[model samples]
Target: MRTSLNLKKVSIALLVVGCIVVIIIAWLNSNRYLPFQGAETTSSGSLKAVEKRLAKLKQAGEKPTLEQLADAFQPLGLIDAHNHNASSSRYLSMLDVWEEYHIDKVVLFGDISEPSAIGTDAAAWKAYQSSPDQFLPFFSGFDLHDEGSLDVIRDNLEKGYFGLGEIAGASTYSPIVSLAYWKASDPMDGFLPEIYDLIATYKAPILLHIDPPNGLPILKLEQALEAHPNTTFIFAHMNAYNSPEEIDRLLGIYPNLYADFFAGFSVYNPDGGGHPEIFIPIMKKYPDRFILSSDSGYGIESEEQAIDAMYRILYLLDDPALAKKIAHDNMMAIIQAQPATMTQLSAIQELASKNGKAYNYDNLSKLEAGKILADAEKG
Candidate 1:
């Protein structure tokens, strides 16, 4: 009878151990802790939550398959803090990619340096008109070094621009982004500081790209940050040419600076060595400082893959709140409800009065003021 009792106790203990192991595996696989809070399912309904898809890729030691990417990003939504080719035919072709990836908003502009690629403010305004909710149209339609570019900036801001940039500040290596016409010698040279302050007065963010992310350009970037503390300078691609440690050091020092964490570079750019995980610690250290971007759907054949790589970067953060912040919250906090300053408003009102539509302008939103000025100019 004692022997029988021992057998029964062993069976019960084994059953309990089996149950515990099963629970542990399930917990590891569950999508509950994913930063993007939603049960986003593919058409098959079998693949739910981007976290699951990312995990499968991690386990298999494989690159992202099209099937593995999310059909639609979750409600939390990604705010693409940096992108180019806005207000152009190429931009229209990429819209479906935005919907599929759940890019809730994009900081949209066109090439400011490349003569063949520069898009006009009118085209940006027209694109914003088509989907004002999804596009944050930044003014980047002119040469940064030109004295006349200030008038263009002032006019567009009065017309309701969200901000300024993807401005080609410094570059020497990129064949695609030739700066023959308008590259700044550094971030602060010539009229760039004045431009920085002008944007600051409107509380606008400017995304500036400076390649070979070390030496003189970085020093000049620091100087600009110090000189215009109010201006939000988004260092493009997290200064893709620098190390994570260097990025961390800069973020520690500059409250006025932020970074567009270009995910494609982190994973695929030969410069960054195919390691998105290397940035995980620094990104976590400065959670609010980093914002995700794809650098104009660069290099990757399918934008789906680009976006999938971004989610993989998010997964490395390992904290839901931190992931959400980098994904969208950080950028949203910067761009949401950026009101036109009283000076900008007064300027627009003056222009309107000259055009014979004098009305009280104290409460006009930036968009409202911009539309009024745009119509007056057109009329």
Candidate 2:
């Protein structure tokens, strides 16, 4: 009888122990997958530890590559607010890279002068048609003095262009470089009233590449902002690498002025090993106004590398929510605010169907006459 009782006790103990083991395993699995939840304490500790390590690295004169910096944090998806579709070949390759890196959306712009070049307005529209869900196409501003400029802008808008930009301002125009040829007419120039009116009327966003000398553009921009409160204006390259305090000041005053981080400024100094101390407080102060982008041009090997660079810089902020807002959410909110119409959708579909293959633009010369002609003939 004693032996029988001891055996029953042993069986009960085994069952209890087994139940405990299962519970522990389940808890670990849940924590492993959902690290963001109930892991705030751990996450904060990790961030501090990383900061310390980065400081040490900076002191030792060791700079980490973007990929190395990115690997230290959990992978988060991104939305690029400012990017160019350089060429049909480059853009198609970038799409593959974007997919690999979990980049959900990209705001693509084209050059007005080179409409048929792989990186011009035509390429952006084609890419958008190919992947309507992935691209937000913005038409480049033409010579404001030209009579045909307004007509071109209106035509693109009617054909489903999301916005207007990469408009050149005094800062971006340079006589020395062949590429920096497009110059914005002086802000006092008479042509802006009609352009601003059209943008406001259509409820479209305008991205301006302004880097004023002696704050000349700021006054002009302020006037434009005050005049067209309904239109959203994105300052390219953080107003030509302005100080964070200036960014804060501008953002505080103008609700419509949004800035994108694209230039290689000291604030984004990758060699510093982490996010700049000055930028963090400013970003926190105006979390919604700042957006992250890879203004990497045609020379980049892949879009994934560019995104990884963005992620690396973003992770340095150490605030996941703020990171999310800058990396993806802010841009998404802007795009969602101006939803695409049925006409736009139908047009995109038609273009996609007509293009057939997305990445066939290996040679620029052949694309205009051969591929486009063949597609048209078939139609």
Candidate 3:
């Protein structure tokens, strides 16, 4: 009878411990949703780290060819404009590839559909804090269906995010899709129109992914483009599944709509998207409309291969000035046009004071201010 009682006592203790463990995990998951959570360093430190990398590159004979530089004295190289979840271990481990290819900047964002994927905006923010110069972080960490999503977008923008996406709007047909479900339904339906207005208010670009590129999606896209003339929408993958003539038509019609031409998808991907050369004429026709990307650096095989495919497209351009425009200038122009707002700078100053770091608030870029504000907020 005594032994039986002891066993009962042991079971109760085990149950109590298990409950505590579960509670701790729940707390951690909730905290992960917060902006800039898990950031390990400060914005100043991040800037210094990138500066050192730049110095090393210069020592290694790397050259800055493009006229537009995101950071002064930094060289202009290929900018991978649509790298999703860039903080993923696989992508982070490939920094050497960025150096080898002379890639100067990458647009970083994360999958925002939670409980299904790495769905926190903090992932991109953390990555940016580590290497602010190498990455331009965009926020898409809110569920489209959530009523609070509008507030989340506005909050992040006010906190100084450079841009708004790589937002997975409608992915009806794609073998490479990471999530089992789409986070957003129709690109123009529900909260997106309001989100576009918020983006326009900040003059920030929103990168959108709508697959199959035809039917009702195209009509809806046109409607959204017409409705939000002030907002800039980057059609992800340059509608890889559609024809170049379609791309030309879209560009000719919508000055507000831009194209994210994923070189990796064009050259590789057995999904039967035509050769990269097929779009060369259209690219030449509308050079400013196109921005190059690696799309999680899939290139069907590896990030390195995807980057190589990008270079191939650059080589085909032949004209250095035109190549420079597509390579980095176009994207930089969109970002630089919007400086850090007075509100953002004020918040940054307050954060800097809180963190015991003295910074010239007047000179901080949106990315820099965002990093500082994020670190302080995390604390």
Model 1, 1-379: lDDT tens digits are 9999999999999999999999998886563322221211123333244455556667888655543444323534677777775656867988888877667777777766545334555566677767666776886666666788788788777567888877777777666555446767788877898899888877788888787688888899998999899999998887476788899888999998898888887676676788778888888888888999877767655555667777767766755556667887787667644665565577676886677755555445565544445555555
Superposed by TM-score, candidate 1 places the C-alpha of residue 121 at a distance from the truth, in angstroms, of 3.4
Clash totals, every prediction: 1, 2, 0
Q: Which pairs, if any, clash in model 1?
A: 159-370
What is the C-alpha local distance difference test score of each model?
Answer: 0.71, 0.61, 0.71
Better of 2 and 3 by TM-score: 3
Error of 1 at 217 (Å): 0.8
Residue 35 lDDT, candidate 2, scale 0-100: 13
- Candidate scoring better on lDDT of 1 and 2: 1
RMSD of each: 14.8, 12.2, 19.9
lDDT of 3 by residue, 115-222 (tens): 333344667767776666667878766666766878887787776667777676676775544352435666786688888887798888988878769887788889
lDDT of 2 by residue, 257-374 (tens): 8888752343344432334555768878888988887775323444455566576557567666677677766766665455343344444446667776342222222112222333
- At residue 306, give the lDDT of candidate 1: 65
Model 2 has a clash total of 2
TM-score against native, each model: 0.74, 0.66, 0.73
Query: Which pairs in model 2 have colliding backbones?
Result: 86-119, 87-118
